[model samples]
Target chain A: MVTTAAQKPILLSGNEAVALGALAAGVRFYAGYPITPSTEIAEVLAVELPKIGGKFIQMEDEIASMGAVIGASLAGSKSLTATSGPGFSLMQEHIGYAAMAEVPCVIVDVMRGGPSTGLPTKTSQADIMQAKYGSHGDYPSFALMPNSVLECYTLTIKAFNFSEKYRVPVILLSDEVIGHMRERVVLPDPATLEIINRKAPTEPREWYRHYPDKTTGIAPMASFGEGYRYHVTGLTHEEHGFDATSQEVAKLLEKFKNKEIRNTKELTMCESFCMEDAEICIFAAGSVARSARQAVRILREKGVKAGLLRPQLVWPFPKMPVEEVYDQVRFILVPEMNVGQLRKEVERLRTNMRVKVKGLNVLNSVMITAEQVVERVLQIDFRSGSESEGGTSNG
Target chain B: MADATNQTAEPVDRHSWLRGNKKFPHMWCPGCGLGTLLNTVIRVFVAKGYDKNETVVISGIGCTGRIPVYVDCNTLHTAHGRALTFATGVKLAKPNLKVIVFMGDGDAVAIGGNHFIHAARRNIDITAVVVNNSTYGMTGGQHSPTTPLGMKAPTAVTGNIDPPFDICNLAVAAGATFVARSTIFHYQQTFRLLSEALEHKGFSVLEVVSHCHTSFGRINKLGSHLDMLKQQRDHAVVFTPELDVEKARAEGKDLVIGLLKKDATRPEYCDQYEKLVIQPSQAKQNRGGV
Candidate 1:
C-alpha cells in the first residue's frame, strides 16, 4: 500500500506495518539483507528510517546483518533486522551471542518454507523449532507471532518491548502470507504506544555486573560510551561477563532459564476467539491462525462447538493459556504449515491434560485452509472410543 | 620505549589499560607477539589521550582475536570473521565512540574478506588492526589467505601453492583512507603506524605481520620465535614511493613496513550517513515542516 500524506486509516502490508512499528518503537538502527517476503520490511525501513533520523544498512549477508544489529543494540540503539528462513538460519550463531551477552535487539523472521531455501516466497511455520533451539547453547529467546497486518504492527512494537525489558533478542516470527498481504490498519499514534527502554546501570562502575544473577534474571545494560567497561563473549561466563570454563558457571544457566523465561508472566501473549462454551479448539500460530479463526466461525455457524486459540508469543510458549483452556475443550487440533512442529510441543506440554491433541499439517509450502480445518474437526467420529487418549502427537 | 623484546615484565598494569588482576597470566602462549602488539595498542591509547569510556574494542575468533578481552575498554569478542561487521555497527550507531577491531589473518582476509573489503570501501570511521600471522593459529594452523606460497599448514599437508594476500594493498584497493604494514620485530614502527591509523578519520588498517610460532612455525620449519623475529627484521624493508614490488619480492623483502596509503579528504561513512539522513530531516523540521 502506498502511504499518502493523509493521516487516516491506510492500507498497508504486514511488512510495511512492521517497519512502521519499528519507527513507533524508537528503533534507530536497522541492518538487514534482501530476502523474499521479508525483504519488503528492509525496503520500507530503508526509506522510512532516514526520514525519522535513523540509520539503515544493507549488510553483505544475513550473518553480518545479525551481528551488526547486536552491535548497534549494544551501542545504546534499539536495532533490528528482518530476514526469511535461510537468512534466519545464518543468524543463529549471532542470535546465541545476543542471548549470551544479553543484548536488546529485535530479529524479524518472516518465515518461508525451508530446510534449505525450500520456498522463496511461500509461507511456512517451519522455523518454529529452529527459533527455539537453533543456537548451540541453552539460552532464553522471545519469539512473537502476528496473525494480521495490525498485529504485525502492534506485536512488533511488543517484540521491541520484550527485547528491552528482558535484555534478550526478540524474534518476530512472521510468515510470507502476512508479510505480503495488504489490509487496512488503523495505527495508533506513536505517543500513545507503550514503549519500554532498556534500563541503564544505576550502580557505579565498580559494583556493576553486566549479568547479575538475581531473582528477576535481568540486569541494567550500559552502552559502549556509558563508562560501564566490560567484556562480552559467546563462551559460558560468570556474572561479570568473563570466560569461566567451570562446572559452577554452567550450573548458573538454570537461573537464566527460570527467571527470564519460565518465571515471567506478561511476556506470553495468546488470543482466543469463540472459545466460550466450546467443545473443541483449533490451535494455530502465525498466518495459519487466520484460517483457524475463520474455521471456528464456520464450525460455530453449523452448531458444531469449535473455537480458535492463537498464540501470539510463540516462544516461552504460553502453555498456561493452553492449559487453562485444556479441560474446557475435548480436542485440540494443531494446524501448521510444517510437518506439525508446534503439535509436538503441544503434546509434550499437555501431558496431564486429558485432551486429544491432533495435527493437521500441510507441507510443500501449502497453507492449511479454513475448509480443511473444518473438515478435520468434523471428522471426529464419535465411535472411535477415546482415541484422543494417550497423549501421542499425531501428524 | 621499554625494551620491546622483554616478555617478562607485565606492561598492561604499568600502562593502566589492563582490566584487573583476575585477567592476568594472560591467555597468549609463551613468546607470543600478541602481548607486544597489545602493549603498542595501549601506548597508542595513552599517547592519544583517548578516554576509556569512549573506546570500543572488538575482535573475532583466533589468538589475535582474544586481544580485546584483556583490555579494560568496552570490549566485544565476536564470532569468527565478523568483528568488522560489528564494529561498523558500533561506529555507525555511536559516531562519537572510537571503534577499533582486532582480527587475525583468517578472521580478516579469509572468511571475513568480504566484510573487510566492504568496510574499507564504505570507509567507516573504524581502525582495523589485522594481525597477519600467515596461518589460522587457533584452529591448529590451517592455511590462511595471508600464508606465503609453498608454506605448509594442517589443511595443506603438501606445500601450499596459493599466493599470499598483501593486506595493505587489498585495503588500499578497497578505498581505505589509511593503510600501513609493520611487523612485531619492528615494534617502534608498528606502534607509530597504530598511532597514525587511530588518528585517521576514515577506514584505516594497520596490518601487523607477526609470527605464529605454534602452528605456522612448527609446520614450516621456521625455527624458534626468536629466529622468526630475526627473519622479520632481515626481510622487512621500509615502504617508499620509488620502491618496486617486483624488486622487493626478488630480494626476499616482500614485507613493505610503512604507511602505504592515506587519503584524508575522502568522506567518512558515519559522517555521510548523518549528513544524508539526519541533516535533511533536521533541516525540514527547522523550516517548520513535519
Candidate 2:
C-alpha cells in the first residue's frame, strides 16, 4: 500500500528494489550464478535486462560469472554479479585481481550466516569482516550497507557510481533480510540521479601509461581495441603493467591504495538521529540499523535521550563522524547480527573516553530486534561504569 | 584435407615482422619446440592476412604462456587454466575479432581441461594451439596429463603411471569442427595445420608436440636441442588418407602429423548466441524504423 507523499511510499523487497535500481542505472550486462537469497537478483536481471537491450548470462559457476562480468566491463558495459557467503568466498581471488587491475564493477553479497555454509537462507552480518579481509593482500575496497529497500535501491546506484568514480570494485553488503524482505521504495527518474563515468585519458595513445599519475590516485583506463596499448595484471605491476619487483615500485602502488579512496570523502554518507543530545548512542549498519533506529525512538520516548548512528559507507569506517559522536555520547551501543564483527572497530577508538561501550552480538537465525537493543541499552548502568568495564549480550 | 593441400603453398616470409631484440632473442630456449611451433603460428596468421590489431592472443601460465607477450596483438596472459575462458569472453564480447589461444599441455590438459572440453563442445569461433611438451617443463620436469607412461620426470621418478591423453582425439570427441596434430620438426606441416585451424569456422584445436630442451632433455638424456628434435621426429608417425581412428590406434603409434577430423555440422557458439540474443534486439530496432 502507498503512503502519503511525505511518509513511507510503496512496498518492495530489497532484492526487487535492487533489480529496479540496476535497471534505472542502465545496467546492460548481469552475469551471476544462482545462490541462496541472491538468486532473485539474477532471475530478475534475466527477465528484465533483455527487454532493455541488455544481456544476462547464468554462468557455469561463481568463478566464471565473475570472469564474465569483468569481460563485459572491459567491452564498455556496466556489469554486476550477485552471490552469497560461499560464492562470495569463491570470488575472493578475482576480487583482488579486479582491485589490482582497477576494473570498475559492482559485486552484491547478500550475506548469509557463515564461516562455511552456516545458514543458506538465513541472515547474518558475520560477513562484514570477511568482505574487508577475505581477499588476500593489502588493497582498498568500497563497501555500502543499506538497512532498508529504499536505501537498497539508492545505494546500489551509489555502488555503481562509486565503482566508476574510483575505478575499483565496489560491494553492496546487503544481508538476506534486507535482500528478501519487502518494504516501500520510490523509483526516481534517471535524469535526477547523478551518474559517474570513468575518466578517459586526454593524452594521445603513445604518451598514455595505464598506471601512471599517482597524484589523483586513479589512472585513466582505456578500453580494449581503443588504439591505446596498455597492460593489466593481477601481479604487482609497473606503470606499463609489467611485473615490477622493486620496493620503490611497491611503495608507489601502495600510495594508489590510499589516494583513490581519500579523494572520495563526499561519498562517505551517514545519518545521525538525535545523536547531538543523547548520552547513549547505538551504532549499526544494514538491517540492524533499522532495529537501532527504532530502539532510539523507543528510548527517546522514555526520556533516555538515546540516538542512532547508521553508516551508509561501511568502509573507510566513517571514522570522522564516529569520533564526532564520541565527544557527545557517554555510552556507545553496537548491535550486530554477527558476533562482535564491527564492534571491535568501535572499541579500538573508544580509548580514554570513559564510555561504557557494549555489543549486542547474535549469530543464530534471529536478527537483532528493536526491543532487544532497547533492553541492552537500558541495562547499561552509568553509575557503575568504568574505563575497563564493558557489557555484551548474545541476543 | 584435399582442399587444404590444393591451396597455394607460398613460403611464409618470417623476417619482416620479427622484432629485433637480441637480449630477448627468442625467449624460448634454443631448440625448444615452442619456438618452431610459434614460428608456424606467426606464418599462418600472416598467410591468413589477419591484422595484428584485429587478432587477440590469449595464453595461460607457463613458458608457452609468454607467447602472447612477444606477439604484437591484443594479448592477454591470464591466470592458470583460464586462457580458454578468457578467450571465450573476448570472442563473445567482440564477435568480429579473431581470437586464438596459445597454451601448453599442462595448462590446457591439467588445470584447464574443463575449459578446453567446454570450448570445443560449444564449438566457439576460436583457434587453440596447444604446445604439448610432454612434461611440465617451466616448473621442472613434472609428470603432466599428456606425459606418456613409463616416462621418467622429476615428479615421477619411478616413471609416470598415468596414461597419456591423445589431445586431438579428445578434441574431435568433444565436437571440435577441426582437429589436427603435428610436430615442431615438421615446420611446414605444422604451419599448414595451423592455417587450416585458423580458417575453420568453429572451435579448432591443433596439438603440436614440441621439444622441451631443458627439462625433458636433462631427464631423458637427450643432450642437446637438436637431439630432442630428432627424438620427436623419430617417435611421430604421419596419418595418411588410408588410415581411420581404429586403424590408427591399432598401429600402436601416436599419429603425429595430419588432420584427424573435420566436421561443420554443429553451429558456432557466437552465431547461436547472436541468434538468441541479438536478433530480437535488431528486430525491435527495425520495427521502430530507426
Candidate 3:
C-alpha cells in the first residue's frame, strides 16, 4: 500500500496530513497522549512511524509526552507531540523548560473550546493567547495556524523546519474543524522535498557553547553520546550551560527573544485575498479563515469591496502585512470561533485608525458560518453609511 | 575527531569525576549525604569501566537533582519529577549508552511516581537512584510524601499524619527488576548496592536514605548531620525476604537496609521495542533496496 504507484492523491484529515508531513520532515520520534481533536495525529503516527523506522510512544500523560519529546530532541531526533487544551495546559511547565534549555521540538495543539475542556469534540480559537503566553517566562515561541487540510500538512512541515532552524518549540495550532475535516492532498515526491537538519558544532568540544550568544543567536547543537559531555539545565545559564544568576547573565539570555523577533519577517507568514482595492477586510485565522474567504467572495459579488486577510503565522502576529492594508480599508471584521481572542490583536493594530474593527465571535465551539460573517459585514456597512448620512443631514 | 574538535582528550583521574573548576565549591550544604550518594555512583562508573562518553546522567528538580551537574558526563537537568521520562527517550534512542537518573523522594514518589511506576513496569534498562531525605530540601523543610508519620516539617508543624512510603518496597511492587535500599551511614552497602543496580540490565532502583540537615533536621531537632547519620546507622536493619515482618516490627527496626528484590526474567523495554518495531522496519527497507 505504501508503494510509489499508490502515492496518488488521497483524501486525508488534517490530523492525518500533519502526521504525513511530520514523516516527510524526518520526524524520527513522536511522544503523545490521546486527547480530543488531536488523537488522530497520535494514532496515525503510531502506525506510520514504526513502518518508517521512527519511534512513537503514547506516553503515560501529556506532561511525560512533552518531556519525552524534549529528551528525544536533545538526543538528536526530530521529535513531536500533539495534544489539546487540557493536555497543552499540563505541558506548559515542560514547554517553558524546552525554551530555556533550547531543545528543538514541535508541538501540535489542535485547538478545542476551553477554559477547562469546554468542548472536546468541538473547535475554538480561544487558545491563541495561551499559545503565546501559556508557558511562564519571556521566551520566544512560533505558532502556525493552518486554515485548510493542505495547509495542515505544509504548515506542520514548516513548523519542524522553523523549530530546528531557530532552536525553539514550534506549535502547529489547528482546530477540530481543520483537524477532523478531510480533503484531497497530492503527496509530494520524497526526493523533491527539501529536508533541513540542525547545524552541528564546528568548534572543539572544550570550546563549544551549547547556548552561544553569537550574531545569529543560534548555538550549534551536539547530541548526547557524541563525546560532547556537557550540561543542559532549565535554570538560567551562561553560554556554556551552567547556572548563573548575575544581571549580566540575564541580559545575555535576552538573545532567545531577539533571535525570533529579528527574524520575524521570515517567520511571519500570511495570505491576503483581494486586498489591492478593498474598503472592508475580514481578518481571521485557523479553520475560520476558510469561511472568511468564502464570505469575502460573496461580499465581492454583492459589490461591497470585501477582502480576507488570513494569518498563517499567528504568533509574533504578522503586523506589517495587516498594517499595509490599514489605510486601504475602511473597516476590519475579525471573525473567530471563540469570544474574541485574535480579534483583540487585530484591534490593537487599529490605533487611531478610522477603520472600525468589529469582532464576529461564536462560542460553544460552533464555527462561524460564511452567511453569518456576510450578515455582520452588511450590518456594519449599513450602520456606517447611516451614521455618515445622519451627520451630513444634521449639518 | 574531525567533527568533534571542541572535545579535548583530558585525563580522567580515578579519584575525581568532577567536571572542572566551573562546578567547584558545590551547592550541597555542609555534611549533606547527597555528596556520598553521588560519589558512590562515580566510583561504580569507574569500577565498571564505563566510558564517560557513553554515559548520560539525567536528573529532576531538587537538591538531589543537582548531582548530574557536578559530574563530567552528558547530563540533562530536566523539570521536576520528569527525569525518568527523559531517560526513557535517551535510552531508547541510543540503546548502547548508559542512562542513569537521579531524583529526590518527592520527585520520585510524589510528583514523578507515575513515571517511575510506568518505567519500572515496562522494565526499561536504566539505573534510577532515588535520594530519600523525607522533605523538600531545596524549597525548605516542607513535608514530602515520604515524610515519616508523626514527624515535624514546615508544612506539618504539629505532625505528619500520613504514613511514609517504603521506597524500595514500592519499586519492587512496581516491577523494577532490581530494587535495593541503603543509608548514608552504610557506605560499603551503598557502594555495593549502587554498583549492582548499575550492572542490572532492566529497570533498577536504588533508594538511598539520606538526611537533609538544613530542612528536616533543623525542624525535627535531629541534631547535626553527623547525629542524623548516627540515627540512620542505629535504625538500620538488614533486609531479607525470609525475615518475619512481625518480628521486625516488634524489634522497632522497620527500616530494612539491603537488597529487597532482584529478578532478571522480564525482557527489557528498549530491547523489545527495537526488536519488535525497529528491526523489522529496517529489514523491509533493506529487502526493498533490491
Per-model CA lDDT versus the true structure: 0.85, 0.77, 0.85
Full-model lDDT, candidate 3: 0.85
- State the lDDT at B121 in candidate 1: 95
Which 10-residue window of candidate 1 chain A scores lowest in summed lDDT? A386-395
* lDDT of candidate 3 over A170-219, digit per residue (tens): 89999989999999877777676666778999888888788887746676
Cα lDDT tens digits for candidate 2, B249-282: 5665545578888888878988886787667755
Cα lDDT of model 1 by residue, A1-395, tens digit = 22323457888999999988888888999999999989989887877777767789998999889889988998899999999999999999899999887888999999898879788978889999998998987888789999999999999999999899878899999999999999987787666789999988899897888878764766788888888888888767887778776764765577568645655478668888888888898899989998899999899899988888899998898878888777688878888887778988888777445577877878767777899888778775352335543222222
Instruction: Give one digit per residue, the lDDT tens place, for model 2 in A1-395.
Output: 11113333577889877877776666778878899989888887776666566777666677767766776676567878899999999778768777776778889999998879889989999888877877888777788998889888888889888887677788899999999999656666556777777788899876777777475666677766666655555667777665676964676567656754576567568898888788888999999999889999999889988988999988767877777777888788889987787888887776546766778887676888899988888877444374244455666
Pull out the clashing pairs in model 2.
A10-A184, A12-A183
**What stretches of model 3 exceed 4 Å from their correct place?**
A1-7, A385-395, B1-12, B280-290
* Candidates 2 and 3 compared by lDDT, better number: 3
**Runs off by more than 4 Å, candidate 2:** A1-11, A245-248, A351-353, A382-392, B1-27, B240-252, B281-290
Off by over 4 Å in 1: A1-7, A245-248, A352-354, A364-366, A381-395, B1-14, B284-290
How much native contact recovery, as a fraction, does model 2 achieve? 0.14
Q: What TM-score does candidate 2 get on C-alpha atoms?
A: 0.90
Better of 2 and 3 by DockQ: 3
lDDT (10s digit) by residue, model 1, range B42-144: 8777766678889999999989988987888899999899999899888888899999999999899888999999999999999999998898888888998
* Candidates, ranked, DockQ: 1, 3, 2
In terms of TM-score, which candidate is stronger, 1 or 3?
A: 3
